[model samples]
Target: MSVSIDISGLSHERIHVVPSPLAELGMALHALSEPGHHPGLQGWATAVSTRLDPCLADRLCEADFLWRSTFSDVFAPFAGLPGQSTLPGATLAEELDQLDKLTDEQFVDAALEFTCQSTYSEPDRNLLADPAVQRRALDLAAARGPQQVKFTQRLLDEPPVVRAWLRKLLEDCDEAFFADTWARLSHQLAADARLKTDLLRRKGLAEALKALSGAVSLDESEQLITVDKITTGRTTTGSGGLVLVPTSLGWPHVMVLHRKGWQACITYPISAPGLTAPPTVEQLTRRMAALAHPVRMRLCRHLARGSYTTSELADAHGMTAPEISRHLSVLKKADLITTRRRGRYVQHQLDISVVSRLGSDFIEGVLR
Candidate 1:
């Protein structure tokens, strides 16, 4: 199965155009940047709590904080939490200490116990492999795909379904849609609850939702709505009521980009037994995979610093234009990077913003 979110070998720029549905799911799963207002998680939390083992669920929560910190500190600008740094030069022992001192033995034992049980969780096993499950997930994907694609086309294309949904949500001070959304997402969550839980936990679902809700509420309280273009992952918007975009694979919930940040919640759909895995190298050619090469990695690093034409990239790396073009071609095919045509030049730049959001979220959280 071709995983929509797969960009393993793609350049960062091309990765931006990742199917909006997949990107939306990715964003929603990690949209836990707020609390009660965390429509995404709250929508699916009940399902998660129901399907996932209590101990595993708790461990997942702990792991979320760990990964969120890791991504936020490593990536910088895209930090999801915002203002947070990776766990500073502290050892595992220290980490246990800062929170509540635990003996090295206790921490190690706890870690092993968590790793063992969660492996068998449903989502980890790939829910889409089951034909029935896959069909249901695909159905939801089909239902929402056209709408999401339309929304992605441009600001004006925002679908009525989304607009109406948002209007209802915004008018209801308590965000009643959250409950319905969660219930709707429950089917998918149940089918892939184990996997969804793992990914959400890994993405720091609990913390991100908490942080996001706080940001949205505070933004609303201060009337901080409407900012310049909001850019997340590779998607950018000028101005519009945020809409929760759905993924073809069916997500645990829905997520929408608001002027300030985001609004999200769990969405239950009928459990589909099968959906393909996230994108992978096996899905791309060896040439396309070259984007993950060392030379390519460095080139991306440079371009991410600032846009540079092919010639400039070659000169900086002491390589020929042809060589740079070869690398750029591979990167472009993988959707990891993109080139914009200037008056007299085409410039290249990195495109992996999904991971960057994780980084951004962390920074925001820690800084505050």
Candidate 2:
């Protein structure tokens, strides 16, 4: 439950806590370890919106659970903070409604909740206070399990106790152990991206090993971390990254390092999972390039889910009606999404088939 660490080299300066409310939700759910609590982060918010609150939809979607998990996996360990549990009744209701509806707005609202603003801005506070935002969140709550509202309210009221644990983890461990922990944490994060439910199951660990097996660094420098060794510790509440110590039975493991007096553990070999094939640097370059325009990337993710009317998609992204139409037109030209006119509305879907063809011909198209 505790460890000592000294990480003078790994300062918190390099650690950039995720600023998105949706990511906080992912971290929160991952912390809770419940499965399918909220639809995978990104487009699910938008998709959920279509189902839960038609009036409160927007097109400004965050990365889906999978994509957001990729980032959270990297950041959660370093950013681990103490957990406090407190939730306002109205806020909890709103959060659940967002989850049930899966509105793009849900992702924004959730990300905003835990995003490290450091100083609260009046504009930001006002946005949150908007009656439309509140109504939509309430609607989302209505769509979830019976106790969702209560649970959410409790969470908003207090941060979890895990932050103190992370601080303790950092203070007790050394640099080498810290690095190993980082790797373990990274692997756990990748597997988690594909994991649909929030439940921290043994299967998630198994999948992580499988992902690492593709490029196991047998190099003596990368410590030989056995599968059994990684599974021993109960993962902390907020971040999905595991915490372990050398055990006599089965396998050997150790705690990751953090700064002196800090209880945090750092892990390495950071990477994402569920790539159809291992990506080359070139492929990664292209993917990054594709995401240069935030709006375009958002559109691609929306299409990945299924065909939706332009209006339907627009509501999810938080865009003006005309803005949505313009983006769709651009995407169509890029061959990323295909559209069909359904009388009053034009529906669009991801052109994965085309993307596959493009990749085969050295013509990379987007939609990861």
Candidate 3:
């Protein structure tokens, strides 16, 4: 349910938020390969999925080996990839070809080693020699899928199987969907990077990191940071400072990849207008329920012109102040509006972005 990162000794200067086209590509491939599993992506990823290689998609769905650090983390950083900004295929091919030199042993060892370690730390050399650790490694492999289990076994036995298959999957992913995905993300990625850099210069590292996502935060005490996750797992020590990457592809949820001869990174959703995550079922229902009420609709119409106080809204809508306050409470809880206190009076303002996103999601969700 959480990954608590202790940052007591780390300097603020070391925590960074940057963009990486390569990591974005890796996440997109996995997400596009399995869109139905991610509710936030299901609406828009349909069009993108139609362009993907079906066979490659199927293979990735069954291959956990591809996700193990040997592959994803090992290949995550392509320092120049983000700067390419276009020609995703050309850039991807260039990076993959360069990484092709990673020996079958090197890649397989990293992959196999990842399953045994508790964190992103280096692999134990004698892991295979210990029966208990070996069993855990096998159990982890089998949990993925039959094909992945086989891939893991083959990699352990031959190690060379890693070379051709991994490269092929990476390349096919590019040929299928990387270009279109990059085009969708290019402008936002550049803008996000610039904004974070500016924030760092104007405010500080603390401000810059805090601005990255609601899911991530550096505590005021600065000794610890908390990351929300689906299931609870053991906390890992920070080997290196954080590398914050902003992207549109990783919607709804954020992902953490620890540093292993590379930067420890968190690739988060881009804080942009067009690519907001689909609201949760509760959120959708709440907002819908708010609109369904005639009284709330009247309130919304009045607030659309400008912000209003509880008393003002009641005055405009011909309702008791207490009754108007109740309606305003519901609308604010649904995230359709925001309340800002100004001395004695609080102003209720419509969240215009939420209005646009609501319309877009309603249309897309209904049609989908």
Off by over 4 Å in 1: 1-277, 280-288, 354-368
Candidates sorted on TM-score, descending: 3, 2, 1
lDDT (tens digit, per residue) of candidate 2 on 1-368: 12222222332222221122222333332312221222222242343334433222121121122222122222222222222111111222232332333223222333332221111112243323466544544443333322334333332332232223222322232131323333434344434433412221434333433443332121223222232221122222222222311111101012132221112332322222121333444554554455457787777665653456666566666688798887777667555677776444466776644343334334333333
Kindly report which residue pairs in candidate 3 clash with one another. Answer: 1-231, 1-232
What is the lDDT ranking, best to worst?
A: 3, 2, 1
Give the 10-residue window scoring lowest on summed lDDT in candidate 2: 244-253
Superposed model 3: Cα runs more than 4 Å off: 6-15, 53-58, 61-72, 75-90, 93-106, 109-132, 220-222, 230-241, 259-262, 271-368
TM-score of 3: 0.59
| Candidate 3 lDDT | 0.60
Error of 3 at 30 (Å): 2.5
Q: What tens digits encode model 3's per-residue C-alpha lDDT throughout 1-368?
A: 45556656666566666666566676675555444224466555687767556687677665633542222554553321222121212256665654554544345545563342333444443343455655556666553345656766666665555667777776776667776777777778878878897897799766776787776776757566677653233233344555667777665446665433334566777743244657766677789888899888777755643455676566555689999988888998899987776445577866655664676677666766
Q: What is the lDDT of residue 155 in candidate 1?
A: 16
**lDDT (0 to 1) per candidate:** 0.33, 0.34, 0.60
